[model samples]
Target: MYNNKFYVVQDGEFVNPNTNHLFSNGLDPKDFIVNQDGERYNFVGFIFNSEKILISFPKHSFSSTDLEKLPQNSVMLNKYIRILFNCIKRTVNNRNDKYVGIRNELNSDYPFIDFLEVYKYYKRYGLFTNEKEIKKFGYAGRISWKDTMNKSPKIINNHNLLFLPLIIKENIEQHVFISKCMAYVIDSTLERFSLFLEGEKTNLHTRDIDFSNTSLVITQLKKVKRTLFKNIHQHLVDSLISFFEQEKTKGGNYQLKIYSFHLIWESMIKEYLRTKFYGLNDRLEIEWSDSARNNHFEKKVAYPDMRGMNGFSIEPDYYLILNNKRYIFDAKYYQKLTKLDYKQVAYYFLLKHFETNRDVNGNIINELETYNALILPTEYEIYSEVHFELNPEYNVNESKFVIMAYYLNTLKVMEHYTNAN
Candidate 1:
């Protein structure tokens, strides 16, 4: 099993239970497997039936020459990742108190590359390290007879209690810790990149980073007191540390998987919208569901089998409240939305309308106009918006809810929304 998930190599391609089902359904494997160019591929990474597969896209999967042939949507994945990284950075910068133990699993075939981009941005400013006072027994510095007596008593007797100076130097504890972190990231990236290029005969030249030197520095830096590093260096160190901590907790190869990407995409959209809408209007409030329980709303059960049971609960991705109206939004990172996806949002809209406050004279008062929307990442050259209105003529009530599709690229959709608002 790879990362505790079973997979088999079939026809030189990795097939997990999920992807296997895709193949069984007669869909092309290439449609689901995305490469760096955003092109669909039949295979990615090394084709091996190993239990511990490398967590990265293979370097040989795409070439610079194939850029023009790539699908238009191929760039959307990278754009989304970039936006997600920026959103997280913004969160770290502003409201740092809320950043404690914040973890998001990255789901992308080229997660390391995405992370490398973020790492490079921070590295450009240089790694954060602090000056630490370190004392060491050396032949030439301040003398310490106590330390000398503790060690080499015979030498002291022969030299009339003479002792070497205690060496003192400013140590970069934070830098060393950061170097150690970077070394791990670099080594893992190289290992996964190697897996992707495993049988190719071409002499591919991979970009090199001095991970060894960083690691050596880490070893030397360990001699100093660790607590000396202050929170001043947290901006750079915390960002990278949180990423590594996330990967380690997930217990998978270094690559970001698609399942995790769904969460990341949802978070990116919420954060992006939050930032964009900030200070624009006081009436607009963006709220997130911290957990399923917190977001849950009870609905009366009528089925015989479910008798005596509590009401069912529904949790939408987010609620965009403008004045008294609530706009329900569900973020789906899939290439296409399914019927169940539509029904789920519809249920939430209906539930909200039904459970809302009623007028004192036995009428529904202030029937908050509701709209349900499916937010999706689109690869279109131009943005598109589609609305499916529920006709009241066919239905029995004046209450209406329009389920709309918001096709947007996170990297460029802000301008469209801003102008419309």
Candidate 2:
């Protein structure tokens, strides 16, 4: 294959680099596969029977120059590109401690074009670190075919035929930090502007008092305002720094263990909205709820498997109310769906709809009409063409529910559902 595309699915699943499957059962290839669309591209077979392999492509095939232009509906491809950019950006910025392994894996001929595209994107962002930094770690520019025996930045923990996601965690964390910094700048700037105006208003109010009264009042007001703004700005900066510091030590564990990962995911969600949907952040509202406080309804409510409170409460990953429509989206870490997964999302929709009632202080007050939806990650871009309709009963309840499952690339379609449900 000169410039064809391929996908690497480990243990029949497509997930992050540090996922457990890459090293599960003590690093075995029996659980892994490289597929061309639905067809299998056996990496183990290539290793054992090198002569029999005739479909290998050069690593450079992944470059943007080699591959044809991506289709307009290339949802999955976008996600892969994001992942590659983040990983390489992590490595390039010196935020991540591992890069060589990810580079090696991407350089492999398995999914030559995808990997190359990822590398090209990474290079575009100035993420691929320089040789000076690489040599400082004494790597000798060689790829190690061993597990994480060394903590050296250049050393990659290789398994039977692949590297663990944790090894590349440094890269992930770096991008996450940059994301948090951007958020801090935005949030802090808004806060500072608000506080500054409040101070000005206070000063103007004090100026109207008697000469003596005004003098003292103005002085005190100035002190208070100065202190207040200083403290608030410092607090915002501290909060941002503290978040990244905590994420830094989160390590390779997923979910709560490496909890800062959510920051990155949420940031991605926000960035996606800004760039693609003309800044929908102002219109979108997302939150989580728990039933432990007996907020209402007969049944107990708690989201079993989501980002933070894993089984702690029925907090939906995203309970979005956009364009007056209610949507409930749950991010599934698992690639493929089992029967239970479907039922779980279905229950979420039912309960969410059930919760929106007159007895629970529902928001339907006088004029409340909206739709609900439950979406799964994109099975196909065409699936988006199918519009959803809301029942009249939900309008009476003044509550809507929707389940949308989506990958990063497909996030555009999901975000576009402001008027979808």
Candidate 3:
């Protein structure tokens, strides 16, 4: 907890949909305790003030009713005394060393190198190195450099609970710069970067983005995007391994080895929204059945990566619902989509099209809405590798075959809709 505020991670039942009230009784997420030997573990703490009882989990709740009872930093161990502002500020400021190590691991011309270039770009473009004479920021010298980063904006005056570190302006601006860079990674070379958004379709439906989700993904993407992005670079290097291919590389081919997964996934989702879902781009309108009797509006369908006790799962890398027709797709990262990949896609088709169903109270429903499977390849395939199994049990091969062409093809389709408007 920083400044008597706590970092709360809410996890439990008793979620109120109407009130948006998460259980008020749960513990804060970041509370930790130190052992006799100075080892730290989970120690939840909360501070109370007035009517608000900042209740944290396990132990430690503070009440402003007893303002004098709060623990001070002097009593707390240094390791356990993490002020959220100081920690994240330290992380961002000292990221150069971590990035240097990352760059050392990859070869030249790697798309990730370009990705890292964004950090440098932001520092330059955002004028982050230069200090401004702001009230909350350390430019006035009242607060420490680390504390300055956690400075909250003046307008968002909700200081009841612990606010995010740094001023809202700096935090958002910095994150937006990073988010734009991530978008560039998708737009530039590879047309995709592996990104895990918080929820499927929620942000898409709204005109504005949820900055919190973007912030979370940016931090996580730095860890995983490095490996996946390098795969694209490695493929380009290996593809030119043939002797004849070497002759065309005299001027040096720009090896854009960016994992196609990110771009392809982005394209598939965006296209599905534009072409199929139309204006309803925000929420995932999926129909699922996981009950004794299949029904459309029955049992609560699991979201996104839905897994069940029976080992039956619905993993839709890109889920498309047009009118009432369902198109389930799983993206494959490959230099070429082979017959084996087709079989894999065919399997998913069977899982989505045939086996998966909706359940009503005690019966099945929605036999009219057709479900189709799509094996969305990362890039263009020279020849159609699609094939159907002769199995009568799951007629997967009967579904239409679509190569998905390129990322632009989807964009083009979307543009057509926009232009028509």
Candidate 4:
């Protein structure tokens, strides 16, 4: 119960304990999950249950800077896991308003941690204010007749009543108890995030708040008496109820749930472009937006109504406006840009086909001048912009194939993503 497990594996590497099904809940976990290109991919995330395991599945590349290594818990391990977790949450919550709830599909479009959205909303718009009777002094409800003679004070006007000791009908102790209960849940989560930190750890949080028990947090929940008002309170009540119910049925003991870490890798790359690369004009200002942004980008390329090609659309990970030129960057999680990636080439042509402006006399903006690259993660530990031209021998003036592959250091991206957000 005390062991803070840690693990650090590349996208497709094999591990010792075989974490395909570490916990009995969720899906029957599998090692070597068939990933991009039908190859097995390792998924990683910090387990938020009783065991406190910190698993990290960085994509394609990671550094040996004494960090990463998700299976064994350590200060370094906690940090990498946190960075990945935060990245996923930010990436999801940025587009979603937290109230949108979790999306369910055969394959999740993005990483989703269970109840993270609800936790976000409840924490933001806390418990509802109670309806109560207010009194002038110490919440003494309803002025009494005996007080008129006993005190013999001037109580002629409403002003006099206002000056008396203020009191409330609802029990103050009950509210304080409830607030503490919610705080216990939040604070404990923060503390557990650092449970495995060794000598290299800092004070994540004291978690000083205490509550009677989890049941009180549930039982003490105030019920709304009216319909047409299933606001945040109602949503939270149902969510928390479902949470505890699933905790028992799923048998995860409220462990930290996570989707594939590649989702994080995609986010990390996007964050790097947004945060680290200064003066980098984000062509897509709504870049952090979730699937909707993907749709938005596709909308820009209006389909030609059953023309030569239809149906599928191009949604580049990033179509940045950097250094006064358009660049299409695809953040691929694979270790290397496999042999033939027609997708990037299609992305280039799709935009050119639809480019009304930013083009030369109805042509695709001088295809040679238009830039495109596959931004992949690398194990290199420094800030690098290593670019590899897909067709190195091709002449840009004639072939106009400005295709390239760029290797960005994973540690660099992680550090920047952690700090920028």
Off by over 4 Å in 4: 1-10, 17-29, 34-41, 47-54, 61-73, 96-131, 134-184, 187-232, 249-257, 278-312, 321-324, 356-368, 382-397
Off by over 4 Å in 3: 1-256, 259-314, 332-361, 375-386, 389-421
Off by over 4 Å in 2: 1-27, 30-312, 332-382, 385-421
lDDT digits (tens) for residues 114-135 of candidate 3: 4334333333443222123434
State the lDDT of candidate 2 residue by residue for 168-256, as single tens digits. Answer: 21112232222223233233322322211111111112223332332443344344334433553334334333332322211221110
| Model 2: per-residue Cα lDDT at residue 304 | 41
Q: Is candidate 1 or candidate 2 better by TM-score?
A: 1
Q: Local error of candidate 3 at 112, Å?
A: 6.2
Per residue, candidate 1 scores C-alpha lDDT tens digits across 1-421 of 2132322221112334554452343333442565444433232222222333322221122233332233233354233323334443343333334343232222232344334543564446443345566656666555555655565334366558543444333344544555545445555554544422212121222234343454444343443324435543444444454344334323232332222334445555565454443211222222323221222221233222233246544456666555565556677765455454665445554556554568777677776666566777654532334446666787666445456666555435433222221
Whole-model lDDT values for every prediction:
0.42, 0.31, 0.31, 0.48
lDDT of 1 at 91: 35
Estimate candidate 4's RMSD in Å: 8.6
Between candidates 3 and 4, the lDDT winner: 4
Off by over 4 Å in 1: 1-258, 275-311, 338-345, 354-363, 381-388, 391-394, 398-400, 410-421
RMSD of candidate 3 to true structure, Å: 29.2
Give candidate 4's error at residue 43 in angstroms: 0.7
lDDT of 4: 0.48
User: Which 10-residue window in model 2 sums to the lowest lDDT?
Assistant: 195-204
Q: In candidate 3, where is summed lDDT lowest over 10 consecutive residues? A: 193-202
